[model samples]
Target: MPSSLTPPPVQASFGDTDVYLFREGTHAQLYRRLGAQLSPGGEGASFGVWAPNATEVAVIGDWNHWSDLADPMRARADGSGIWQAHCPSARHGQAYKYRIRTRNGDVLEKADPFAFLAEEPPATASRIWTLEYDWQDAHWMGTRGAANALDAPMSTYEVHAGSWRRKDGQFMNYRELAHALADYVAGLGFTHVELMPVTEHPFYGSWGYQTTGYFAPTARYGTPQDFMYFVDHLHQRGIGVLLDWVPSHFPTDAHGLAHFDGTQLYEHADPRQGFHPEWNSAIFNYGRHEVRSFLISSALFWLDHYHLDGLRVDAVASMLYLDYARKHGEWIPNVHGGRENLEAIDFLQELNRACYRDHPDTFTVAEESTAWPKVSRPIEMGGLGFGLKWNMGWMHDTLAYMREETVHRRWHHDRITFSMVYAFHENFVLPLSHDEVVYGKGSLINKMPGDSWQQFANLRLMLAYMWAHPGKKLLFMGGEFAQRREWTHEGELEWWMTDQPEHRGMQLLVGELNKQLRGEAALHQLDFDEAGFEWVDANDRDNSVLAFLRKSRDGQAVLVVCNLTPVPRQNHCLGVPLSGTWREILNSDAKPFGGSGWGNLGEVRTAPLAANGHRHALYLTLPPLSTLYLKRDADV
Candidate 1:
């Protein structure tokens, strides 16, 4: 019997990709597996759909749903504008979709007029397949820096397989995706592919977040085998794959996981623990043992089955609270009297531990925003055991500096400083993701403060500083090109703009930057070491600049300076380690990264005669919004 405190059952159903939770006391673990059980080996039958507004809708064929004809739908009553039926005779082989009603009913939503991988007979969705995929990621290693190789500096390429490519006016299948995505990411120099959820879904606009099937990849892209092929191809190209694991909540679809198998088999038996108030999605009861095993097994399933490198746990903040959206008595309290959702935390820890245990190198990053302590700390330390937690503070702080009034930022130096205190405690990634430039936020390019020239300079300066910072780094797709407009997931990258001098300049800068990142003696060597960092200067707001240094463990020193002013500042004083000639090895304002021609290249600068008391000193002309990397080899 369900508990009286159990939340009301939501109006949703089950399909593939439905994430369920296993609970124990106040803890829950998440699962990321794939599979659909419809009475093992049941004969083919028509799987019906209910899409209102469609004066008429039909069932399309077929995977392993044990369905018959591709066109079997029974209309519904109560004017729900729905139609549904079953196809028991249809085998799971063909592609399918619905003949939904158009606004004018003249032309219906025709199998994604821009459909990439469509089935014949022009259906709406693919039949659920029960086939298996074989994969091998022998060459693609995992994690880095004591952490799993999968958790290192992850510059992920976020992609929607269907809209990412189109040839012959049709969407490509999984095989096509493997080839296309591989080429794109390899060329761009991204290390991982963070694909939009691949869970089987029905809507094109939802971007796969509203999943319909928990255990199945969307047949829209092709077969499950093709998806695996994509991962394999990514590994062959030296790139890793990170799946978007959404265990926080679920979409409320009628034929989905909700209330499936004659009960709330996949969701929480009680309403209190299994409902998400904000997203209107079904939540999981993290207190069930069965749910915990299911969630943990799912994570292991993906790593074992797809040879995936990692998982980016989405909406983690939503999962760690008992009163996420509640204002009153609907929620319960833990032993501490706090309103924390203890079950979710438990499940999360279990999932992290299991993933680490199964594939010691598999990485897990939490997309958590709240000030949850020790989120990235080890499990034995009484913390959630994610391999890396998004350094959201870095993202928000950096973006705020770029967007808000700069004059106000001086007082907010502590905001940026706060990032470093926790940076070394656990693995962190400085991310500039899709969230930064969506809606009214504008693109990175548009966020530039000064004119076009200053904008590019600022962007480059920030990148240079970011690379020099002590932690893993990530930049969103199109950011490398200094995209001018906000991102539109529906459109392809603004590749056409690559021809522009500024855009091309940004591209070249990224390439060379990455090259330097690997070859430079200052970078890539003991970068994450706690002792390798120091704050040399921060009071340069008049010039709107800041300077810092990254020291090698072997005593090799590298100095970085940034000048954000429009006019070059003469004899700018920057405190340094050595009073000798510090050669300028790299500068952002140089023509290399599409900035104004104001830059000094390879200029071994002479230091000031007088010292700053503590370390050696240097006084050099700093260009506006330019970043310079200087290496001091000798102690003069």
Candidate 2:
């Protein structure tokens, strides 16, 4: 959170900016939120939202239809709080807001339910114009769909828009955000930016999980047009954008879509079936045709609208379980009650299928943590159908290992090495997500078990291992800089640490890691679908050393040796599959990443034995808690 001393980075960054850092791309907004052009497509469109409470509600502002309606909303005896009215003579290049009469018999300002653009005010809401930009994003997506290089090292930069920067307790706009954020992210060398949910929401907190509008980009940040320009700008810089999407549940807002149309239009009708016990949110009835359509349409809307490269579905475990949030009195037993949200499963499959079918290049990733089979498998072969599933087990297992790891006990081979068993079974991404480091768990940096020096060493090694692992890699924001505090969206990254060299050093390492991800064959295409990665020493836990070889189907391999021990070891014996020379590629013990001045650059060792019908064996000195990648050829 922003410190009292600093008033939080949010105040500094969001300071009256006209844009946000992570805006949607141009041409990416219209397809998601379709609107009928008012007045022969002259420009402005009048929209009416249903908010039944108290009395008067008016569409005020640049529309000028009711800018003077001090108590804009009108009251009805129904007491349902349904406020509706047409914005007369509404047009573009203007602002608006809801002049609503609250239940307390008092008037207050609220943002428009359908407004695409919002200003930080008393700021008038801008009249939104439908995006009709001409371009070739669809064409760009088409090529990546067929055979885009999935083999390139994939290092993703995770971002959160609201907390990324909010000055004066206000949000930034899409236009301002796009240019600044694109330059910042692209300059960092990240191949992709994984943004937290941008879906429209009423509250500023909840990190967007309590979503009210399935398709609307939060007007809290900016306008649809501004967001679109952000996306287009990023694409021009060669950055892939992945949106954080929430289809699992909806917020229980009274005026929102939850009970719109005077029915359970978006969620289940029964309280037992509709609500989440812990979250106090509404669950969808995926079994319903319209519900399924809503979700499927949502997936398409993002892909088709902003031309986002992909989406990462949130809280999939809740969606996967029948009694996810069940309490003693509020739960349902699905035959076995061992988590059988069948409709959710079907809905997932359909969503993935539609995305792939409509745009093969576009990806749909699930945040499911269970042992759900074939999460990344093609839908044809009895799978939930996702381009990728978060390797949640790997995250937990690794974090667990680190918490207990030290210089003395060496390491437990089984505990540290079990993730590979399933990490790559289906296309998966290893993520140190916001879930693992937020709300008191602390940041990934603080998870390490030691003082400043040791902590930095451990973090670098962890990231090295994650990058070299079989699956793709992602790190939540603030983690790159080794922020020693837990995450709170109310503030910007622990920017106070910016003055510390260690913090800035970690940031540099992140930038370099993102660059390294661009062409590392062993990372991108290595065993993406069961064709790469093997453990040469899976059970070598005694020395706290784990070694493995990751390869592509073409027979190219890179050996990774990681030592979790605190003290360096000499000639750590390990198995080798080749008899040729293996040279050192990347070493975490190097000075650039704030290592303990260990590891030799370009050190090469020839294998002494043969295995797997090849003499690919090698031996070399190993550093404590350091990761080194060995390349088999100049090409690797």
Q: All candidates' lDDT scores?
A: 0.64, 0.67
Top-TM-score candidate index: 2
Residue 378, model 1: lDDT of: 88
User: Per-residue alpha-carbon lDDT of model 2 for 1-636, expressed as tens digits?
Assistant: 111211101111111111111111111122222222344456544344334543445556654654444223333233323333444466665556555444455554444434444443333343454545554445455455533345556667788887776666666677666777788777777777888888776666777787755656767666665677767777777777889998888876654556544456568888877887778888888876545655676677777767888999998889888777676657666665555788788888877877887777777788988887888787789888888788888898899888774854444557788886666577778889888887789788788888768888888888888887887788887788888878888767767786787777777777776655565565667647566777777666677777777776667677888888777877666666655557777787777667776764476666566643445445577776788887765443
Off by over 4 Å in 1: 1-137, 141-153, 163-165, 168-170, 269-272, 405-416, 521-528, 606-614, 633-636
What digit string (tens of lDDT, one per residue) describes model 1 on residues 178-270? Answer: 887788777766667787788666666666776655545677777667878888888878887888877777665544545432345456766
Position 5, candidate 1: lDDT: 22
In TM-score terms, candidate 1 sits at 0.78
What lDDT score goes with residue 28 in model 1? 21
